[model samples]
Target: MRVLIVGGSGYLGQFLLKYLLERPEDEVIAVGYTYADENAGPIDHPLTKIDRCRAFRVDAATGEGMDACVRAMAPLDLVVNCAAMSSPGKCEKEAELAMNLNVPTHLCRTLLEHNQKSEAIAPLLVHLSTDQVYDGESPNSVEDVNAPSPVNTYGRSKLNAELHIAENYVAGRHVSLRSSIITGSQPPLRPVSRPLFHDFIVNSLKGDEAVTFFEDEYRCPIAAVDIVAHIVALSKLAGKDAKTDWLMRYNMGGPDRLSRVDMARQTAEVLGVSDANVEAVSSASVDRGVISPADISMLSNKLNSLTLVSPMGWKDQMRLALGMAKM
Candidate 1:
């Protein structure tokens, strides 16, 4: 199988590349813009050292290096889009960049043209969306039934990307995973740019100063590995024998609805650390430069029904993330 993972240098992208490459039959191609740090010159991405995968430095937003990438790896079996300017503050500040990076229109058009030229089946595009598309007024939001009412630029950009895929790829050759907060360890062979939520909680509990977490904000955080698993399952269903009329959008989230404070408490309990310094606060009190939704918890009934895989609860997810349990 030939796979193309856009934004392959990012956190979840690296995880997908590492997991998919475990299969000897798979040929993985990773493309991203930030392979090297701006201050560090042309340092190589650690994942580039992997023998089975080919890595390319391409900016999906500007369409630079895309044609060359498509020409090099045509007739792809699957294309997983993990590209996005995910930070809400950054998205709000740079709306244009957010839209360009979040939306996969350029990537889709390039792939569509190549597929048309080669006369091959369009590869399944497993795009990574966010649960922020919800209005936050409700919990366990269902796909399609609840109309998306985004409260921020990040969510709006993500929603637009989903719309593009749904309208353009009408044959059900695409899967838009509206994923919640993805928490896990850093990707192997990659530089840790920032601490993940799980790490932030753990580090705070182990430190001297009090750390504040939003108790009112709620999300169904899924382990990174589980998201990769969903993509793999969807990839297996691709091709002519696959179901063409199946649902295109799926809510990919963990089974439990938890807040940041709830996660911190659970992490402390699981890791046998003291939570005395863990502070619980409301989201309304914080001025994060972006409007954060109160409750974006989502139900993954559709994803579970399709993949036949049940997501782990918060505690187990914490354990897996902290390296207490096997992946």
Candidate 2:
């Protein structure tokens, strides 16, 4: 299978790219904007990158660099979009650019148009969305609901993108995955990337003994590796009579209900930091932040009904995360 990722350079995209490459029969093509000029070579890495995978910085906004990027690739079996101007502050600051680059509302429309006109295989579109949409899922809401409160401009824009993909695109050709914040390995020159858990471990390990975490904020989390693997699995199911998710939205939380404080404490445990070293502070105490929802839980996996697979403990992944971070 030939796979393409929109934001192949991002934290989640990096994981998606890595997961696909592990399969000997798969070919992964990673497309994104390269901020650093130095590492923008042919993108052939040893472990994480297979020879079949190619990563390039293609600016989907303004349509610059997209033609060549798309033209060079083979007809794709799957196209996973992980690209976004993901930062709320960044999206709010440049709303228009955010719409173009971050939201990709227009860009996705263009891709569908291109798909209709071109000879390339109409690939399954797996758009990675966010749980921030629910603004912590207001009272009486169930896990299957796709409607969101969208607390920030970023969340609103992401919701907009999700709607566009669902309403305007070809049916049976797309899926929207709404997951909580991701935590994982941060690649070099990729400061925009930070794992929610690993960052705390790093902070704790660095002798910043007293680490501050948001007290009121809540979120569901899945490992970046798991996210990519799920996406890859979805990619393999393209055009098959696979079971559709509820209303095109999925809740992708880890097994545990975690707050910013819970994540911090867990990181402290992984790093062997004492409980006293982790502090639960209010969002207002932060230098820069948002008055976010008290909780935004997501449970995307339909494991019990479909495969009967139990959700794995998040702590094990947390341990791997800290170990990898230290290496």
Candidate 3:
């Protein structure tokens, strides 16, 4: 299987690349962007750990290197788009850059065009989307969307891009995974997500240090491995064996849902940290303009029903991430 991953050096992408490389049949090709001038953070990122895969320098925003990406992995069996500008604050501030990087609506359109006209094998595309498309106010919101009333521009742009892709590229086999907050180990080493650093804040409290978290946001923390496992399983799920609900879309949610405060408390509880170590900060107190999803739970793991559970959850995953941070 010739598998290609865009944003292959990102938080989720690094793990996906490593796991995909484990399969003997999979010939994985990963494309990641890096700035020549910017201080490239962690040189030893998770993407660098992938054994059987190769990561190339490419920009998803401008389509600067996609043609070469396609040429390298000619006649691809599967292509997963995990690239996105998911930061609410960043996207809100830099709208054009965010739209270009966070949601590659036009890039996807280009890929769809290539898939349609190409004599080479048309690849199955799995686009990583978000449940944040909804305001997430309801306790029970399914993947079947009523209206994507995104509270933030990041969500709004992603939802719009997905809609555009669906409307324009109707012919190809594709799936849009709509899910909640993804908790994972370190994103290898990347310079992009500084404030979004998961390990530093969590472990500080767990180590009897001070911790502050927002109180306004509520979300379902899905494991990063859970999201990738579903994508891998979906890549193999054939039409005859696959169900109707699993056809073109599915939600990649987890077992329990939680607010930002509750989630931190649970982390403290799971790690046996004291309450004093955890501090509840209001969204206003936070410097970042991160949107608080009132409730971004999932409808069902109809996708997971066809697959297995990710061995790591937030607690275990966080522990591993902390270890990685130390390294």
Candidate 4:
């Protein structure tokens, strides 16, 4: 199978790329972008250095170089979209940028044009969405049962992106995964400076400065490897099944519903680190510049039924992420 991973430079995207490349039967193309910097050239991610993977640099926000990317890799079997400006505070401050990057309008248009020209089945689009689409009032929210009520700009942008894919790609070749907070370490091949929730807790415990965790905010944090596995399983399924009439949307998350404080305490216990600097605070006490949902825990019954892969527990997820457990 031939696959295209947009935002392949991201944390989750890198994991997908690494795992997919291991199959040896699939050809993987990674498309990543970098901000313009006079002082430095584009980022030289270690994954791009691998000879087996074909890498491209494109600005998904502006659609620059996207047409060339699609044209170069014609008749793509699958396209996993992980591109997004995911920071909630940044999304709230720069609403337009968030809308442009998160919406996937340009990416979908390019793919549609490609599909119109090609005779092969349209490449299945596995888009990574967020669980923030829920209003936090409900827990273990089901995809079809609960109505999406995004309160912040980040959630709104992602919800709009899902709508666009559903409207345009009605042929059921597209899937929207409303994923919760993805918790794991950076990909081995591609190290990241930005820390994830697990990394933040570990760093705070190892350092002298205090780190405050929200006791009110709740999320079912799925491991990065689990997310990658789901995408890979879907890609394999798409290869076998040619049916393109059923629209797919799944709530992708772990089984545990944990608050930030809960996660921090767990991390401390798992890694045998001190939680002395880990401060527990309510979301109401913090002014993060965006309205945070109190509880967006999701039930992944649909995803499990489809992929046949159960979500990992938070403790095992932490071990896998920290390289303490086998993959």
Which of candidates 1 and 2 is the stronger one according to lDDT? Answer: 1
Model 1: colliding residue pairs? none
CA shift of 267, model 4, Å:
1.3
Give the runs in model 2 whose Cα sits over 4 Å from its true position. 25-50, 118-121, 137-143, 186-197, 205-209, 240-246, 287-289, 301-311, 324-327
- Candidate 1: stretches off by over 4 Å: 25-43
From the highest TM-score down, the ranking of the candidates is 1, 4, 2, 3
Q: On residues 37-60, what C-alpha lDDT tens digit does candidate 4 reach at each position?
A: 234334464455675676666777
List candidate 4 stretches off by more than 4 Å: 25-47, 207-210, 244-247, 273-277
Expressed as tens digits, the lDDT of each residue in 171-212 for candidate 1 is 779989999998887676575576688887888899888899
Residues 1-327, candidate 2, lDDT per residue (tens digit)? Answer: 656677776677666665655656543444332222345454442322545555555665676556555555546567788887777777777788777765556445656667777745567778877776787655323455545878877788778888888788767677777776676555432444444556655566567457677777766666676676566565655544454453465566567677777776776676665667667888777645544556676554562233233444456667656564332
All candidates in order of lDDT, best leading: 1, 4, 3, 2
lDDT of the candidates, in the order given:
0.83, 0.63, 0.65, 0.81
Model 4 clash tally, residue pairs: 0
The estimated TM-scores of all candidates read 0.94, 0.81, 0.81, 0.91
Residues 243-305 of candidate 3 have per-residue lDDT tens digits of 234456566677766666777776666667666866777766755666656666665556666
For candidate 1, the 10 contiguous residues with the lowest summed lDDT are: 33-42
Whichever of 3 and 4 has more TM-score, that candidate is: 4
Q: Supply the global lDDT for candidate 3.
A: 0.65
